[model samples]
Each structure stands twice: as C-alpha cells, then as structure tokens.
Target chain A: MMQRPPTIKDLARALNISVSTVSRALRNATDINPETRQAVLKLAKEMEYEPNFIAQSLVKKQTHIIGVVVPSIDSNYFSEALSGMTDCAIEQNYHLMICQSNENEVLENKSIRKLLSCNIDGLLISVSLQTKSDNVIKEAQKKHVPVVMFDRIIPGADCTKVIVNEYEGALKAVEHLIKKGCKRIAHIGGPKDLSVSENRKKGYLDALAKHKIPVREELIAHCKSFEEDAIGAIRKVMNAKPRPDAIFFINDLSAITAIEYIRRKGLRIPEDIKIVGFNNDKVSNVVEPALTTVMQPGYEVGKLALGVLIDEIESKSTERQLFELRTTLVTRKSSR
Target chain B: MMQRPPTIKDLARALNISVSTVSRALRNATDINPETRQAVLKLAKEMEYEPNFIAQSLVKKQTHIIGVVVPSIDSNYFSEALSGMTDCAIEQNYHLMICQSNENEVLENKSIRKLLSCNIDGLLISVSLQTKSDNVIKEAQKKHVPVVMFDRIIPGADCTKVIVNEYEGALKAVEHLIKKGCKRIAHIGGPKDLSVSENRKKGYLDALAKHKIPVREELIAHCKSFEEDAIGAIRKVMNAKPRPDAIFFINDLSAITAIEYIRRKGLRIPEDIKIVGFNNDKVSNVVEPALTTVMQPGYEVGKLALGVLIDEIESKSTERQLFELRTTLVTRKSSR
Candidate 1:
C-alpha cells in the first residue's frame, strides 16, 4: 500500500514543534534558532519529506513557469535552441513548459490557450508557417504575459523578437557558389510567406546582380521546409532549361534531401551541381561530402530570447526589444 | 490601450440580457431560446471573445494538462516520441508540458517539482541514468498522480511501463551478424545502470551462446551512449585481439560515430567491420553506407504510453499495467 507523503504538520508532530517553526526552518528564515532548524532539517531528511511546492504555489497565486511553443521538437534547429533555453532556465531558477505546434497554426493557438490556462508568467514562441493574424498573440499580451518571438514570427507583433541576419547569411552562401565558377545558381526557398524566405531571396538576387548574372525567375522555387516537400521544389530547379549548376537551399534538411536524390540519380556533387544550405544542423556534418551552409545561432538565440523574456516579466515594460543575432558561413565539401 | 476580453457580463450588457442567460446560451444549454442562443453566439464570434479556460479550470478544480519529462528533447528517438504524444494530445483535448532533464538526476527531480506545482494530472517520465531513488516517484503516487515510465525506466517501480522486447531485438541483431560469418562479434553497451543496457547485453550473450561463439571479455565494453563517450568504448573493442568483425551497438548515435571514425581511417564498412545498432534514428539512413539498426518504434511507444497514462488517470484501480511494444531489425548497407 502506498503511504501519504509526510507534510509540514507531520514534521512538526514528529519534532514536537509548531508548523510555522518547521516552515521557517525549511525556508532558512533569519529568526529561527540554528539548533532547532538543524534538528528539524535532519528529521525531515530522515522522513524523506519534500515540501509540497504545489500547495505553496496555490497560496502564492503564481508560478515561475515559462511557456514555450515551437514548431516541432524533432527539428534539429529548434531542439538545439530548446537545449540552450533549458541551460539558461536551470541557471536562473526557472522552469519551462514546452509545447509543439507541429507547424500548424491551429495547434499553435491551442497550445497558447493551454499555456495561458497554466498561468505562465511569460511565453516564448516561433510562429507556425500558416499563422497569419496576430490576434492570438494579442490575446496573451492583453493578459500582461510578455511573449518573445523567435525565427518564424508575426512581423509587427507587440513582443520582443530574436531575429537573425538571414540576408547576410544568404548573400555569403550564394557568393561562395558564384566564386566557385558557377554561372547558373538556383535557389530553393521556404514558404513564400515567411520573412526568412523573403530576406534570403532578396540576398540571393542581390548577390547574382552584383556578379552581373541575370536572375532567372524559373531557377527559383518555394517549398515548405519538410524534406519530402523540398524534393518537388528541387525538381523544379533541376529541370530548368539550361539547368542550374549550383543551388542554395533555405535549410539543411532540404539540402540533404536534394543530395540523396541527386546521388540516387547518379550525379556527382560539386563537380556537377554544387549545393549550399542554411542552418548548420548536426546532420550537415554527417552527410556524404558534408554540406556547405550558413550557421544560424539557434542556441544563443534561445538563451538571449529567454533573457529578454525574464526581464520583461520582472519589470513593467511595454517597450519591445528587438535583438539580432548574426549567422556565419561554413564552407564544407558539398561546395568545395 | 488594450481592451479586456469580453466576458459574459459584457455580452449580457450588449444584448440587454441576464448574465446567467448569456452563460447558458454560450454553453448551448437546451433551456435557452434557440434565437437568443444564436444571437449570443453570433455576437460572441463577432467580438472575438474566447472563453477564459483558466477561469473555468479554477472552478472545476482540475486541469487537462499532462506533464512529460525526458532525458533530452534533441535526441531523434525522444523527439519522435514527443511528436507522437503531441498527436494523441491534440486528438484527446489534452495539453502536454514537456521538460528535458539533460540526463541529470537533480534536474529530473527539480522538473518534477515544478510540474507538480502546476498541478499536472499525470506524468510521463523516462528517468535519467543517474537516478537512484524511488522516493520522489512515491511522493507523486501518494498524491494519487499516475506515472508511466518508458524507454529508460526504474526497474520494479510502482507504475505502468511501456516495455519493448529489447532482448529479442538484440538477439536478432547479433544472430544476423553470426549468419554473415562474423565470428569475432563485439558489443558496445549503454550505461550499466539502465535496464535497456542489461536486457540488450543479455540477448547478445544469449545469441552468441546459441551460435556456439565465444564471448571474449575484451570484445565487450560499456559507454554512457553519448556519441563522444561511445568513442572510447569503440576503441576498446576495436583494439581487441583479432579485432571484432562485427559490432552490435546499444544505439544508432554511437554506431554512426564509429562509421565516421572507420571511414576516416581508410576502412570500408561491412567489408572491414560490420555494425548494427538499436534505435534506427533518421540519421541512420542518411549516413554513408547507412547504419543497420533495431527499430525502436518511438512514436508508437509514446502514443501507447500516453494512452496507458490517461487510462490510469480515469480508472480507480491502482493495478499497474505493463504494455509491451516490439522492435524490428532493419538491415541496411552498413551490415550488408
């Protein structure tokens, strides 16, 4: 039979002391006698008694829980970011309640609703691909719960944001391929609606223009970030008349998918068609010939985003902070 | 200025109706006039008013939130499992709050305390390797919360479990190598503390005995299952006399690391050293010469575990249910 956990009262009774004295000892209150506190603590440890944090939180009417909503936990980028957040949370004595939206806007809103019901002090979110309106976000803000947006976000939303230099990263990626003597460089972009796609596309176009290469509208295609969806976009570029000799993908997963497909079709990487991608995902290093890519600082972004959120929660600040993190180019065998 | 969310009282004032009538109309109570109900619903929709779930939950004295704690969210195995849980949660009108322990015992306990503070309805945990006490678990049970363990578990704990036939899977992995004419088969195992490590090792030994193959002490080694840690374990087995012709790794991450290391040493896979591993991570298929592994069916395990947890939550019986999921051996280029 399972026995009930010993409460403060139980500890008090065992020591012939008052419940308030036990509580004071547990919290290391300044007024408690050192000897009495030591005895209470030793007995409490002997009885394997852990304070009821739930009961305390109920009386306080608050919790130190931060709600986080991301597109998917399986994605390497998001997972790395979450790990960074976890590290920071541990140091700051905060707890994270994470939810995955699976890249669906409806699920994202539902997750927000659930987090709100938890009375989360603050929220960290990366909007799903299909999110259009900022109303759900507005609802959370109205409750005075600060929200921090990262990566995929609603532009102009009243929240702090973790932004990356996607434009610069894309430019460097395309220029590297261009300097490799590639005349026709195609691009595989993300969902057309995403700011990431727009910025990267602009960078790609600007790089080609700087090199005096005509932008071929037929050479660019858009796809959702999933590998399977990317294959079609890749085919669109691969089959272009005067087919592109190089490609710049928005992320590593899609780039890896293209590599798998090209190899299956008996094509040689670099010598025939060079490829580059964004997000230096761990898989980028393990793939054959490795992948050349732009590295998004996902971990740092997560850490900094959480820091901004905590500041907002503790201070009565409505002024939003826009923090920008830079991405770097990593040249690997896929481009070499 | 942000406006307060329209409440039943606001709806009542706008419609010139009683607050009780408005609440009844919103909840679709049959006693309400159909026309009045339709009017209230239409106005509610127009005003962008959503029910305050947190308020409703307070009155109900419970929540539908389930707490989940995993070793790491970044691992492919755990991420896939989390995704499976997410799907079930969406279907069942439940929410999951996930915490990552980062494989630390203290963090696991801390995360549990935080989750308990949230008044979670049920808990699903895969214990960290360093966890040595059941006292914390027993405390939660004393509060009448159902806990379900999966993948990594505390043996003989008073809880439901999602068990896979890991021994059968390991037996198949080694037997396949034996059939391939590999006499010097090595095993790279996980932390000695994990039940998974124990069961898989037992199967490896049992398989070798059945095949009349000798198990050399030098050919067996242990690691913590992280890729970096597994490198030392791999080196130990690889340096054994007449170096093993085949290796059955505890998981895919370590197997992939070995593959990378072997390739760098100018060795060919299968021909030089055949390898098989557990948990066919997605990267297993992407690696050069693709790794052969035992499929752990993470998604199914997660879905089933959550189902079991929900059942235990609703049912009064404290009877523990041990549900078993099976693993399958997937042969790929690395072992072929």
Candidate 2:
C-alpha cells in the first residue's frame, strides 16, 4: 500500500482550525491574518501537503492549463516551438496540454472541443491545412478564453497571430540564388489551403518581378507539403522543358525531396541545380552538400504566442495583436 | 453575450426528471432506462449540449486524462513514440497531458507530482537518465494509479515495462561491421545509469567474444547519451594508437556526429573509416553515405506501453506484463 499525503481538511483538524481558514491561509488570502497564515504554512510544510489542483480549480475558476494545438510534433521546427513554450510555462508554474490534429480538420475541431471541456485557460494553435471553420475558435473567444495563432495561421481571425516574414525570407532566398548566376528559376509551392503557401508564392513571384526575370507559368508546381506528395511534384518540375537552373521550395521537406530527385538524375547541387528552402529544419543541415534555407525563430514565436495569449486571457479584451517575426537566409552548398 | 448550452439541471427541469437521472441518462448509464437515455441523447444533439468533462469526472471518478513523462520530445525516436501513443489515445477518446523533464531528476519528480494532483487515470513514463528514485514512482502506485515504462526502464519494479531488444540490435550492428571485414572496431557507450545503454554495451562485448576477437580496453569510450558527448568520446578514440577500422555508435545522433567529425578531418567514409549507428532516425537518410543503422520499433513500444497500461488500469487483478519488441538492421550506403 502507498502512503498518501495529507489534505486541507486533515491539516485543519490537526491545527484545530476551520477548513475555510486553512484554505484562506494556504491561498494567502488578504482576509486571513499573517500570523494564522504563517502557522498554517508551517503545519502544511511538516505534513508535506500537496494541494489537489482539480479541487482547488473548482472554486478558483481557473485551471492554469493552456492548450496547444499543432499539425504535427515530429518536425524539428514545431518541436523547438513547443520546447520554448514549455520552458516559459514551467517558470510561471503553468501547465501545457498538447494536442495534434495530424493535419485533419475534424480532428482539430475535436481537440478544441476537448480542450474546452477541460476548461483550459487559453489556447495556442497552428491552423491545420484542412481547417476551414472559425466557429470553434470564435466560440472560445466568446467564453473569454484567449486564442493565439502561430506558424500556419488563419488570416483575418480575431486573435493574436505570431508569424515569420515569409515574403522577405523568400526574397532573400531568391536573391541569393540569382547572385549565384541562376537565370531560370522554378518554384515548388506548398498546400493550397494554407496561408503560408500563398504568402511564400507571392514572395517568389515578387522576387522575380523585382529582378525583371519574367515569371514562367510552367515553372511553378503546387505540391502537397509532406514527403509523399513532394516526389510527384518534383518529378514534374525536373521533366519540364528548359529545366530550371534553380528552385525555391516552400518548405524543407519538399526542398530535400527535390534534392534527392536531382541526385538520382546524376546532377550535382549548385553545379546543376541550385535550391533554396524555407524552414531551416534539421534535414537542411544533414542533407548531402547541405541546403540553403530561411531560418525562422521557432522558440521566439512560441514564447511570444504564450505571452500574448496569457495577456489576452487576463485582460479578456477583444483587441487582437499580430506579431511578425523576422527571418534570415542561411547560405549553404546547395545554393552556392 | 455568449450562447450557453443547456445544463443537466435545465434538461431535468424541462423533462420533469430528476437531475441525477438526467446526468445518468446523459452518460448512458445502464441504471437509466434506454428510453430516457435515447431522449437525453436526442435533446443533447438538437440543443448542442456538450457534457462538462470536469463535472462528469467529479462524480464518475474518472478524468479520462493520461499523463506522459518523457526526457525530451524533440528527438526523432521520442517524437515517433509519442505520435503512436497520441494516435492510440485519440482512437480511444482519451486525452494526453505531456511533460518533459529534460533529463533532470528533480523536474521529472515535479512533473509526476503535478500529474498526480490533476488526478490522471494512469501514467506512461520513459525514465530520464538522471532518474534514480524508485520512491517517486512508487508514490503513483500507492495512489492506485498504473504506470507503464517504455524504452529506458527500471528493473524489479512492480509495473508493466515496454522496451525494444536493445541487445539484439547492438549485436546486429556489430556483426555487420565484422562481416564487412572490420578486424578492429570501437564501441561508443551511452550514459552509465540507463539500462538500455548498459545492455547495448554488453551485446557489443559479447559479439567480439563470440567472434574470437580479443576485446581491447583502449577501443571503448563512454559518453553521456547525447550527440555532443559522443563527439568528444569519438575524438578520444580517433586519437588512440592503431586507429579502429570501424566505430559502432549507440544511436543516430552520435553516428551523425561521428560522420561530421570524419568529414572535418578529411577522411572518407567506409574507405578510410566505417560507421554504424542504432535507431534509424530520419537524419540517417539525409546524411552523407546514408547511415547504416539498427531500427528500433519505437512506435510499437509506445502503443504496447499504453495498451498494457490501460489493461492494468481497467482490471484490478491483472498481473504486470513485460513487452520486448524486436528490432532489425537497415543496410545503407554507409556500411556498404
């Protein structure tokens, strides 16, 4: 049999005090006298009493539980963001509950409802590619629960959004490739439903337009953001007439796919096909010849998202704040 | 104002039934008549009334929340394991609250205590290298909460343990190098406290003994089970007399570090030096020469751990079961 810790009632009885007084003393409530609070603390310490958090939340009306919803946790970028969030939460004595939707809209909604049922204090989300409904998110706002968006965000949503400057990152990547003497450039776009994909595509097009390099309609291909979809999309781009001298991919996963395809064709990186990718993931550094990509501050985004959400949750105001993070280009052998 | 869903009290008032009956009917309890249950379900569906999980847990004594404590979630192995656990949990309509101790014993104990305060139904833990207290684990057991250990496990504990055959995987990795005509091989060891690391080291020694190759004390180096530590240990082995023909690393992180060191020294892989690693992480494929590794079924360990935990939680009389998963080697360009 396990030895259990003492509860508030047990402490109250041991100290010859009422349960309410014990609770107020534990909470350090202003109504409780300082001498009584000190006495209660000493007894609680001797008893090694750990408050029942669930029972305490019932009266305080706050669980201090934050819900984090993400597309996947396997990627280094997402994991880094989560690490930052957890670090800050630990320092603040808060807890984070993670939910992964696997990029499914239905699953994402289900997770939101579950978080709501748990009475989470706030929510942090990176919208899934398949997410289309704002009903659940709006419902959270109505209940005075703050929502903060990060990475893949929902445009125009009435919530604070933390994001990287995709347009500038793309421009830097394309500029680096052009400086490396690439004339014809191609682009591998991400999933159509995501705002990041559209933003990156716009950045690509603007870079070409700014350089007076005519955009070729046949040079752009919309690939599903993951690994399996990348193979088919890259194959099509490789087979195109006047094959691209350089390519800018929306993400590292698809960028590495293009590199693998180029390698299979006996072509060398930079010498035959220069490439640049967004999200300087671990794969970017591990790949043969390495990869030139844009580095987003995942940890910063995470910390900011939590800080912003916590502020909103406490304020309960409808005002939304949008945070745009700056990104930098990391030059490597792939685009040299 | 936010739209409020009908509560059990509201349903009882409208249907002329007691609040207790309404609550039971909402939960589909057998004690409530089938007609009453159907009526409650019909009304709930029409009115969009979602049951409050906290309120329900208060009465049923089941929170439907599972606590997961891991050393780190950023690694490919742990991430894959978590993915499998999350998939299984979602299928069962259960939610997971994950916490990482980041390899600190104090943090691990704190996380466990916090989870217990939340009244989680069960716990799934992968003990960190710094974890040394069986008392901390026993505390959860005393509360009648089931715990299932995965990957890094403790011995002689009265609980279910799920693990991969680490010794067998290490043996295969060593045998591959021997078959490739490696007469002198080196083994990089992980942290001393972990059971998996000790088992793997033992397997490497056994393989050498069986092959009639005299075990050389100078060929072994121990590192903290992390990439940085492995790099330092590998450097020491490289500087030794009669340099090893091949090095067998404990995991992919260390293997990748060794590869980087070799490249920096301008030595060719498999020609000047041969390398093998365990845990076929995604980095294995991206690295130059494509790392040859033993693949542990991390996802299977996670699924099995959760399944065993749920089984034990549901049945009070069930005996503790140990699950050992099989591992296999994947030959790639590095060892070929």
Candidate 3:
C-alpha cells in the first residue's frame, strides 16, 4: 500500500476532535477556542499535515462533494449504477451525498433543494417516473451548479447524460425472437412518459415492420408501473383475439412473472410462448428456463455519468454532451 | 392534495438565487447583499413561509439529516433495507447522506469520517464485511453523533443494533433439510471472523445435535467472500468422505450455485440430495425447483433501524438498545 498523507481525518482521530473542529482550527475560524486551535496547529506541524493537499479530505478544499439523487436504491439497476458512481467518486477523491426520491417528483425536487443548501459543487440525478417538470434543473443551473442526468432523465433538459441504447436493445431482442421463428410477437411496455419505454416500443414496432409483420395495436400492452400491472399486461396480451407466439417485457421481473403465469396456464416456454426481457438482471438466469434479455450495463452508465459530471464541473463548459451505451443481447433457454 | 406551505426553496426560485443564498439572507448574514435579503424577507412574508416549522425545509433548522454507510447497495438485501430506511427517514423529515464502502475497511472508515465532517445529526450504518474496528464509531460519538448499526454489525460495540436472528434462521434451514430425510448433511459457511458466520454455524451444529446426528467436522466448509469462493466451498463439501445427502448454505445465492453444480454432477435434488438456504431473496423462487430458504425481512430491519436511530438521537440517553428480529423459514421444492 502507498503511504497515505496526513490530513484532517487523521488529526481529528489523534486529537479526539471532530473532523469539522480540525477544519475550523485549520481555517482559523472564530468559533474555535485558542487552546484547541493551538493543539491542532502543533499536531499538524509535527505530523506534516499539508493544508494545500486538496485530495486528502473534504475539508482540505472546503468541499470536494458531488450530490446525487435517484428514484430508489433498492432496485438492482439503480444500486448497480450507484456502485459504479461510488467507485468513480472515491477514485477521484470526491465524496457523494445521496438522496432517494422513492419515485416521487416532490421528493426529487426536495432532495435537490437540500443538496443545493449543502453547497454541493455539482449535481447528478436520475429522474423519477413521476417527474414531469424541468423547472428544478433550471433552478440548479441558475445557482451555477453543474448538473448531469443518468438513465431515467428529462428528455429536453440541457445537461450531460449517460444512458443505455434502449432502442437498439429492444430491436435486437425482437430480431432474435423473429429468428427463433416467432411470428406474432407481443410487447409489455412501461409508462409512456419514460424515454426508455417509448424508445424500446419504437424499436419493437420497427423490427416487426422489417420482418413484414403488421403491428397489431392489441398486441402492444403498456403497464402503469412495474407492480402487479405487469400481471395485468400479461393477461391482456395472453387473452388477445390472436394470442402472441412470443412476449417481450420491459424488465426481467415482469418477464419472470409472465413466464410463471403462462406456465400456470399449462403452456410450455418456447413451445407455446417464447419470452425476452430487457435488463439482464441476476434473476434473468436464475429463473426456471432462464430468460433471454438485453444487458443494460447499469454500472458502466453510472461510471460514465460521474466522469462526465466531473468533467462538466471542472471545465465550466456550457456545451452539453450526451452518451449512449450499447446493450448486448444475452440469449438463454427461453428464447430458444 | 393538502395545500403545501411555501418555504426557502420557493423563496430561492422566486428570487432566481441559490438555496444557500436564500438561507444566508433568511439568517440575516453579513455576506448577502442587502437588497436581496429585503426581497427574500418580502417573499417569505407574502407566502407565509414559516422558519420555525421544522419539517418544511433544511433551512428551517441547521440540519435534519442522517448519515448512512453500507457495504454495497447493488445487493438486493441492502437495497431493500435502504428502501426501508428511506421510508422512515423521509416520514420523520430527515434527509439521508449515503456512502458505500464497497466492502473495504479503509473506505468504510473514510466514509464515516466524511459523514462526521458533514455535521450530521445521527448515523445509520451497516458495517462492511471487512470492517473490524469500533474506533470510527467512537470518533462519531465524540462529535455527539448517535449511531445505530444494522445487518452486518460490529459485535460488542456500545450502540443500538438492529439485526435478524442469524442463529434461528440457520437452525431452521438445517432442520428443514433434516426433515427432508437427509442422513449426512453438509454446510457451506461464511468467513470465520463475522459474528453472523459464527452464530449461523452454531445453529447448524445445534440443529444436528438436537436431531441426534453425530457431529462430522469434515462436512463443514467456509468461504471467505460471497463471490466465486462459494463454488470452491461447494466443491470442498461435495467431495467429502461420504458425499453428503443434503447441503445447507449460508445464503440463497450460494445454494443456487450448489444446485446447478449438483445437477451437473447428475444428482437430482430432493431425490438424491436435498438443499436448504438462508435469506429468502427474490431469486429463490425464480430458480429451478425454487430454493427452500429463511426469510430475512430486510426492509423491516431498515425501517426499524432508522426509527431506533432517530429515537437515540432525540432521547440522548446513554443507555444503548439492541433489537433482534425473528426469521421465518419458507419451504420450497428444493428441500421437499
């Protein structure tokens, strides 16, 4: 291991003081007592603690912090993205202040305000499904805080963004199903407002058209959310005038639900109804016949978002950048 | 919808200024321009903004924030728990500042120090598997920051802890395997130093003793981490003197891995060798033959931990509390 430099954290531990206290002493603030300040100074001198060493601690630069807000951390997608964010932040010696929106727009805006009050250097956010306003982004911009959006984002917002290629992923899935001799393919899509949903649905439509298969409006089912709505969507498609030979779901959980529901109806996978899902989650493979899904690369999306945010923060650039990562199809037993 | 009260965020947006600037103006700080302060004061008066309404905004009080550190959010268990923590914290009008340790002790300590520097009111942490010291908690205490541990914890630490009864979960799993008429049972355990590991191992042993099965030390195999070591542990136990009739795993992921491995070895589950795992994760039911495992209420654990931390923070009692939750076994096809 490399020898670490002396910093405010080490001084706080040695002096039995809070890191903020050590910071106050270093800044020669009015609130600190003379004796405490003297002890901190003496200790810093003895230990060769450098105030100019910016990467050592948050206090070294007053703040080397980035604020992040997400819809939820409990979801595998967001959590994996969060892990990637953490890796990049720690590598660059910046700390993260995270807030979860729980898919509520009000909470998302409230979280942004809280982070702004904390004087965050930059902001990173993944918009919640309920988010309908870009007013919060404008407010952040007016405050001179650079902003970056990831995954579930505002379509018209002027900011750096990192997202997986939803359209391509969906197109590939549809093409693979067609190759597997699926003639009448149906889709289970997400809420219409989300870009991911719209893009994927478009891909599904275009792929069907390319294969000389006419789009049947009844074959397309949209769920309000990723809850029991998935089951409702499945029932709607399975009970269609012409039942689909293949089903493509918006996510792995929904696809897994469909698999079980179809099986309970005494249908064999691939033999009765082939299946494909997006976001190659761990459960995609753990399921009985295993799922053929598109890998969203959540971790890469997060890492790239953080890197872009840091670039935007340091460059002071008004020009926005958009990055789209390609998703690969992972074929499994269900699709075959 | 209930009429929402205007707060400093509204004041900031109305004035087209940063939230920090609005906060400074509200405090009558010397740094803000006089005209801006006057504008803010007028807006607050017109909108009936209440500075004393503790729940309205972060500016109302200096801080209503709790710092949280976890090993990794990408895992379903922690993510579900985080969702619970978020629910409780938001309900109680507190924001969360989150940091991920990524299962590194150095990073865990660094994260705790960063949270302390933010001057958080209290802390809720689930220690990383690598965490071995209580020194950081002491440092947090020195700053009057109350902390509560959840999930993976530092045993014997003088603080509130909310954890599932690991011993009970493990015993239930092992007993279920025995009930399936397994004669020679084997176990794939966790790392040696974790209290969770020791408690679970004890449960496995005691369950066998209660069943009057002779102790076979060779049937036990320990893995260092939750990664590929699980496969090695499976190989170790499966190659024992008399290949065990049943395998009890510490967690569901490992048990699934064993299921696949045993099937590849041409062993039929429940017919040749039964299996039981701990933690009824979502994937448990998705897997082939569905895993028989113990249900760990991660979300409940998180909600309870946050509530307890808030109580400790507000009550300011020196007495620490410990909360142990019970686990229920979910019987599935794998063990039957």
| TM-scores of the candidates, chain A only | 0.86, 0.89, 0.82
Best by lDDT: 1
lDDT of 3 at B42: 91
Candidate 1 at residue B96, lDDT? 78
- Per-candidate TM-scores read 0.78, 0.88, 0.75
Q: Least lDDT summed over 10 consecutive residues: which range in candidate 1 chain A?
A: A53-62
Per-residue C-alpha lDDT of model 1 across residues A159-201, encoded as one tens digit per residue:
8898888998999899999999999999999987668789999
Interface RMSD per candidate (angstroms): 4.1, 3.1, 7.8
DockQ of each: 0.28, 0.40, 0.27
Q: B43-103 in candidate 3: lDDT tens per residue?
A: 8888756553223222332356688899887888888888888778767877677788888
Which candidate number would show the highest TM-score if scored against the true structure? 2
Q: Give the alpha carbon lDDT tens digit for every residue of A196-314 in model 3.
A: 78899999998998899999888889889764458788899999877899999998878877876897789989888899998887767755577899998999998999999888878
RMSD of each: 5.6, 3.6, 8.1
- Chain B, TM-score, each prediction? 0.89, 0.89, 0.82
Q: What range of 10 consecutive residues in model 2 chain A has the weakest lDDT sum?
A: A224-233
